[model samples]
Target: MANNPFKYGTIVQEPYFTDRKEELATIKESLNSANHLILISPRRFGKTSLILKAVHATKRPYIFINVQRAVSTADLAELIVKETLKRYPLERIKSFLKHFRIIPTISINPITNGIDVTFNPGVDSNILLEDALGLLEMVSTKKERLIAVFDEFQEILTLEKGIDKKLRAIMQEQSLVNYVFLGSQESMMTSIFEKVKSPFYHFGQLMHLKKIPFEDFHQYVQEGLSAVTTESNDLAKRILNITGCHPDYIQQLAASVWDLLNYKKLDREADAVDTAMTQLIAVHDLDFERLWTGFTKNERRILRDLATLGKLSSKDGYATSTTYSTASRMLKAGYLIKTETYEIEDPFFKNWLLTRLS
Candidate 1:
């Protein structure tokens, strides 16, 4: 059997990457114009993959950092420096570090042959962070324009009070590099970039990423599945409907369906879809259970109501202020999303909850 034609849970490259022609063009144009970009999207919307593709299309060297991975200001500083070093040699970065007051202890990891950087304990990491940004700007000036992407940049708010100010200050002075800030949390990202009182207000061109259109996504999935299944068109529509064209889940569900049709010898397309959905829920059963248990009694009630009602509102047994508050909190935490009305984000989770409740 041919290998699965779908991919998820990591950066997807060409052939596997679906249509984002317009978004890809816009990002390349922004990069070429040296405009800093702020891209906002909910989780699993393919923001990272789209940005990386644009950067690669422009053939520019990039430093990509997942801000969520950093636990503290110091860790963030080290991450920036380490990514910079990966793209350049230590000899080149040494001169830039000399200008800063706080010099980090840099060593080579014998196992990975990668650089490991650390600062002394009790050092003011905010200062170290500032110096690190300054160093990046300095190094970028010596070469072609660099693209520095900070994924989940809203986490900076939790790292330090003034870190946003420090970042904006450094970014304003940077001329040779194009900065791309990606965020998953809509409210926090808006608070950082859109609000007037925030340090990054009017800092860059803001772009809100949305889900792939159903038609385009359906075509991609259809083409991929045609390699293995004779019923590609019907199966493609089922996958899109199941995933709501969510980039990550679409690929994930399609992969499962492909495995069933190719390896399991499933002759009926409907059975493949049903079997894939069942398998997906079983695989994520533990995660869903943990999430369900983590919620308060009120939150779980709201989840059940949203799944049953299809679109939740105060008229649908949510008359109390406490219940509304619980739904609001769930929305903020990304458990629910609002379109025409509020609904659960994960379709499989909703399916599991419905089965359990029934």
Candidate 2:
């Protein structure tokens, strides 16, 4: 039996992985250059995958922390130290951290068998963050190079004011450590890194990852299905169009298509895709409904306009219900993304929305 050519719902590696060659190269260069970078993309654009690939490619010892999983400043502090120890030697780490006094009280985490770096919750969160940065800086100097990737980094905005400034100040002292701040919340991330008021203003190189081009996505889909049947590439292109080239959706839809064809022995490729798409939308129905409930009446109208008109100002524009400022806010909030013009970021959401609004 042949292997499954598609992967979804998790990180796809190697032959299963499609593109992002340029992104992979840039991250490697940044690792060597100590280039702090924030990799921003809408969810499912494979930004995290590129970071992981670079971790393996770069010679520098690398640590990856998912910032969203951490709830408090202490959690963030504990996370940094724990992930770092996974790569560095324990005694050497303890010896190095002693100089910075980041984790003065260390005890083994009974659950994971890893040491937990405890700090006083009474202390200012900024101070705790500062100590964590100090520890990373000391380790970087000792190791010659250390790269830390903070995924879902925009969650830091949930903290108290000036956390951005404190972090920027902390990172500035580090000479050998490279930081990659990866985020899906584009608006929040923009405020943190692009707004002049943001302490992270101009702190790193900005990279806005674009959706996969039709040619690459189309060709990749074709290649993946090549072994199963002598199907037309047109069927693959339809899947890309259906998913708007959203990497995760494309992979998910494609995986389902492959299964219907190979497992259920569907005849026509287009029929198989149609069945797969129905299943895909059904699976995502609850998620779409949850998103629907979060919007205001104006935002809902805007989505309806985007679906029918494909741009603002058809039948009812945002200008009618809300100001252009509101539209801009939505863009920053990641409810919409602008390409040739503004549209719903999730193609599937637009489809579901049109059904309700129409």
Candidate 1: C-alpha RMSD to true structure equals: 2.3
Among the numbered candidates, top TM-score falls to 1
By lDDT, who's the top model here?
1
- Candidate 2 residue lDDT tens string, 51-94: 88888876668888898888887788878877777878888787
Q: What lDDT does each candidate get?
A: 0.86, 0.77
Candidate 2 error regions (>4 Å): 100-111, 120-124, 265-267, 286-297, 317-323, 353-358
**Per-model root-mean-square deviation over C-alphas:** 2.3, 2.7
Clashes of 1: 0
Alpha-carbon lDDT of model 2: 0.77
Clashes of each: 0, 1
